[model samples]
Target: MVSTRTPGFSRPRGRFTGRTRTPAPTSAGPSSRPDRPRLGLISRDVPRQRRENTFPPTPDRLNPAHLASLRSVQLLGCAIAAGWAAAFPIISDLPNQRLWGAVAAPAYALAGLLCLILPRRFAARSAAAVGLLGAVLVPLALLALQGRHQSEVMVVERSAHLLLTTGSPYLQHPVVVTDYDPYLPAMTLFGMPRQLLGNGDALTRVAGDARIWFALTFLACLLASWRLLRPSRDRAPLLPLAVLTASPLIALALAVGGVDLPLIGVCCLAMALAERDRTVGAGLVLALACTLKWTAWPALPVAVLLLWRLYGRRPAARTGLIAVGVSLAVILPSALTRADALREQVVRFPLGLTAIRTPAGSPLPGKVLAGFGPTGHTVSLALMTMGGIGVAIWLLARPPVSAIAAADLLAAGLAIAFMLAPAGRFGYLALPVVLVIWPRMAARRWSGKPPVPPGPVGRRPRPERPEPALPRG
Candidate 1:
């Protein structure tokens, strides 16, 4: 042993006498093998930092060309809307004001030029802000002008007054305007607060300025829609916001003080709520919208579909019931008070034997078809009905998987209705178009990663199991 055995090897005794064994390694004072290179502090820390789940990775920025295009389109919309709104009051108020309508064209062109000269990076936000400001200011300015011109606002004001005093808004014809109180009873509610505060002063009554109220409401709706529909981690909501805020039809509708804005607002809010899984709230709001006008009726079926998809058949049926109850609660009082008159005015007037005329700048295919007389009108109506039915069937066949999809389908249904309507304003199509397009654009931009599908409401996701460790050599 002294002459030949290795230090770590031992000769076996007794039963193991025939074999020699090597001793196992003892304490690891240092690696017995050759010295290995050490990782520096930066290299060690970097991987450790990545392993920690404290921070999320940064999102990619939008493309420069896409951003620029978005900004340009937004600016153009804002400029046009602002110019149209500014010109509307002048043209409508002054005796020979139609001449001033031409002034808006040049003003819009100049605004567009100015917007183009600004830095491209900030252009969309700047333009959107400008448009939003214009939307607010233009209506306020019109209200302040106190033009005393005959408008839908006057109809609402007078109807509200008549409802309070004469017990029937349809009994007396409003001053100079003669469509016979086609508005729903809930519409009078909006005008009542201001009229009731007037204390019977004629000037105060006429100055109720429902247009201002409607414009403010519409603005709020646009903001809410933008917030609800905007994609996570994206900053390009400006274009969609601008498109809605700066629409010429929307501007015109606001300028004219039409009652359509409230309907649009309520419908939009309902859709937003439904998207957020607030089924009961959405149902209540949708009911409120239905109380305002017939415009929201087409959305009801879509709402049902959304509820069914989100919460099964029972909840969907319950929501529909709630909606119907709310609508009846609002509508029944007026209907009971003046059943025949309300029916004739609200229903007969809108869909009577008389031929309906399209709005002045209507671009509906129906408008073109209407030029061919009775047969054309019939064809237009039939086509519109068929188209609407087709869309409904399509929706039923392929139910939407998300709130955004539901909205798109609902908007599509509304668009079909607007296009087919025997009489409709171009503005009627604006909300639907924006609702359909904005979400799509946002989705397209933020689709770099596949979205994590949401779990059913109130349920937690299953946790993933840890992987088995790899064997070391």
Candidate 2:
């Protein structure tokens, strides 16, 4: 190994260089800014100038008080989410995320409200779990049973059936969102149980619901991933199941549909694996995610670079080769089976390059620009593509050797992609949101020990000798 430090952790270091300009005196800044804690990111030490210039981070977003507070946040978030979820049915061309969230939201809010009302810490965590079943899970099960859910659930199920009967999951011509099988071949796995069981009775329908499967897969992968991440001596308790289950985005996804959830969970597992120097294990897990969607492909290279930095070339090489081979093994066959369908559905439809565009129009920067005209759409795509390329270049030049840094980099890159894609939605933001939050939640799981700082892997950063001039990228 390159350094004695555990594979999973890296010492936090700020990247500040000496030549950076000084900022105005802290005394002159806004009254509220003085007490605001600056969130540290990256491997190098931040200069005092940069620290002084930074804005106050959001309390709910990055620095919550505790797991109990997270439950409160979840419930309170659900309460406010009513406005957002209710708007989906009224505003969107399709009721995809749906009115179900409208119902689930308040239920979570009530859970949070109860905790706030009770004035006990344990009440918050314990009640939140009850809230999850009552507020979200019950509704989800009912929706699945009644077949009153988003079209994506059925789309995945149909794709699985097709994959079983035919060789590929996509259709020859898909004119609607439901018809388009934008997900890659591995996604068919989630729908297989439903296809085999057939929607005969309420029991089977609820049991075999693809949404249920998606939720299960997500929870399983998440628990397994975090278990790998926690230190052996310190057994940090995971973010409460109640809080995670009742979380606004998570609950909404469970109620409506979330093939993306499983993919995110698996990717988290892969990152955790890589952090522990389970080189081949990380690659295989990531490959499963990569085969689910093109969005997950970025994680592969990040994992490779991390392995190379810590475990050396041969392990990284093995991982890279295994991941690439596994992905191709599934992808190439599916593509060859229905080349035209795959191109039209997976590639064109998702990029908004097709005649029938996706319903993922959240009026985000990418979609707003795309709404202008073909030129605007092209510009949106180009910008998104550039964002991706820029991140790739940065990863190559300053590859993160630590798990948290890699996750942060991945989160930032994904956020840029979701923001700049010609077809994007609010729900897609959950990918980055979870990626950033998961690490912090993990760190804070133990009661007494201070949270682990993210930074450069292997060893403490050596003091830098002043350069003649900073080397150009």
Candidate 3:
């Protein structure tokens, strides 16, 4: 330079002499600096671009081994369900029992074989198709062939007729030959459309069978539950979905036309909605379920606990009030019109000393207690109540953190209640047990994560995080 330095430059001095001179600002703006480079938006995004491409997208298809195992289980379940439906004719006093068995056994066997051999997607669809056909056709065929209907269906149909004719479903029917309508007024309402058009003939009643309604509704619930419980990481939850949809108990319920299927379906839907945080919808559906039967009662407390954990006490209380209000709205008119009848038939009769006598052959605690007479009934009732209460407490104390967990907790509670119940059906445990266990089995085969070790109840799990790297010298 003439002085070899710009106006504000300073040369290094003393021990810093080996270092370059410090640069200073000239008349030129900061951009004129030679040592500094400007970073544009594109340059700044380079690291982020690399991060975005660091890992490949997760696979959409399930592991083949897992799929095979799941398919095997599904085929086995479908075979059992089909066999059960087909054998119904032989087991019961129905016309063409052997013929029906012959037809149904082969159809189900062929469907199961098809599912076993087809590709996974097609297999799932075929299994679902077979299940739907079985649910609808088997029950209708039974209704056509059998002389007597399931006791609950008979009672419901009779109640609907009574409601249409005399405006009091709770009143005993003269011609329908049912002992009593043990269901809530809501059930009679469900049967009214068909009853109104019918001349009270078995054919017309069968045409608008309440079991069909229950079966269809149950299928809808399965679809909704499958959608909700689907894992975020997995694209296809085919295995669990098939297990749930084609459950033998569900098929049996559809065939027999039991009132429990509708209640179970509603309860499952409510749980799914609640898990999705659709509080209002959940409350309304839960209220509707409560109106159908007492089997859904335990879900009320569980729903409340879930809402309380997710939204806090106030919202939970409000949702609870909404559920109670809806239930009262649906039930009160009938309650007011026939308080004595409703109380005696819906409440007292089900809990009556003789209720367990119908299923005396069952191996449950209640069934076993039936042989001991009134004292045993009383003890069974107390134990059942205590068991239900204990399960409720356990759920409230720890509250499930996810939908699957909620289903498991709810299923456990219902199972305990049913097992100890004075008049519980073993069939009542089927859907709940399946909902609780199927996912666990599927998860063990499909999930890549390590299994969580069992911990004490009410303990919150801590998340594991990686340690920070130390700076190098």
Candidate 4:
């Protein structure tokens, strides 16, 4: 028949047909070809850093809401940084703050502007990274190397020394604001590293700086809260968290002082834990925060209200009992042992009643009023008291049933207190601002998802009805 199998390789009759043989795959060692999938063995040859960084998920790019959120954060952050940069030279004479404002802050603003102005959506993440590096990491490194930090660092470290030597953290009589340890006893723990490490070298000095400990505490609590809010193993909102940390509200104080950071962070953690119904954990965390600073005390009642409004009396009782009990146990012994000293440093000094003038030179209304001698001081205190009464009434009138409501209420109270305090820095306001923002951001509820608003006490909230789809013709 006309050679039906006409092709060249017609299995050369008897020569090649005894048995059919299959050819083996080409010896392309695992992942040798660029198109081939990497095997476990092939991954070994890749650089550790390269392998880890390679193929990172670009979820933000895919999600428009998330990308828009990132841009908004960057834009807001840049504006704040620029404002700080321009104002520092005029308002603050502190060397560290001045240096950071001149160098780091401008760099941060520039990076953010460039990133935002670019047409590329992918630039958002790169911009956040760059901003963080320029605004926080680099400046922090410089400060540590130069052994130049805010006076609060010295005060904290000195308190640690006193704690070791005399079982108390404050001086008997203080000559200046810096001489007084204007913090609770628990704050002394951050200073322990410096006392133990002995600032012998640059590295040691950096390691010994109390700011490092303060930063670590804040970062730890923040990460914990993030985890508690989002339980997925891989769902760490690290990028947003980093951006928040690098924002002017945090980075400026963090670079120079950051004494309040640990307290702020722990308080946030307590709220997150309580929201999840982990009463014991929440109580303990709140107790830690209360011990760290008096500012954190307001958070306790707010948290208690949140628990009570949500789960009922049992959970609220458990959290309040643990928080109040543990914090008292920590505070009372020290308060009793060194009553006069603690009063001078912790109470009178902060209220601007001390002989030594407060170094807090902010032109805020409270500070301005307090600067005008005794009458002004009394007026500021009275106003502050009235503010507190107002907030307390509001708290009782409408208890928060949701985490967002709780946070907002607490932040409002703190902001009022800070603004009305006889002796307070402009920097202190960061705590309130951060409290309002960080919790929502950590939960990933801001910008993308709306948080549940507080409902009537003892009544279940109505479920949200989904919007009807658009009808097609």
Among these predictions, the greatest lDDT belongs to 4
Candidate 2 local lDDT, residue 216: 85
Task: Name the lDDT value of residue 448 in candidate 1.
Answer: 24
Q: Count of backbone clashes for each model?
A: 0, 8, 1, 0
Which window of ten consecutive residues has the lowest lDDT sum in model 1? 12-21
Model 1 misplaced regions, further than 4 Å = 1-107, 132-136, 148-150, 172-177, 199-207, 226-243, 355-363, 438-450, 453-473
- Return the number of clashes found in candidate 4: 0
Cα lDDT of model 2 by residue, 335-436, tens digit: 887889888888888789888887655868998999999999999999998999999898889887666667777888999999999988778888887777
lDDT winner between candidates 2 and 3: 2
Residue 279 accuracy (lDDT) in model 2: 79
Error of 2 at 454 (Å): 16
lDDT of each: 0.59, 0.71, 0.62, 0.76
Which window of ten consecutive residues has the lowest lDDT sum in model 2?
19-28
Question: Which candidate wins on TM-score?
Answer: 4
Evaluate residue 368 in candidate 2 and report its C-alpha lDDT on the 0 to 100 scale: 96
Tens-place lDDT digits, model 4, residues 316-393: 999999999998998898899999998888888888888887766887888989878889999999998899889989
Native-to-model Cα distance after best TM-score fit, residue 223 in candidate 2, in Å: 0.6
Candidate 2 wrong stretches, greater than 4 Å: 1-98, 232-239, 445-473
Model 2 lDDT, full chain set: 0.71
- Each prediction's RMSD over C-alphas, in Å, is 12.2, 13.4, 12.4, 15.8
In order of appearance, the predictions have TM-scores of: 0.70, 0.77, 0.70, 0.78
Model 4 pairs in collision: none
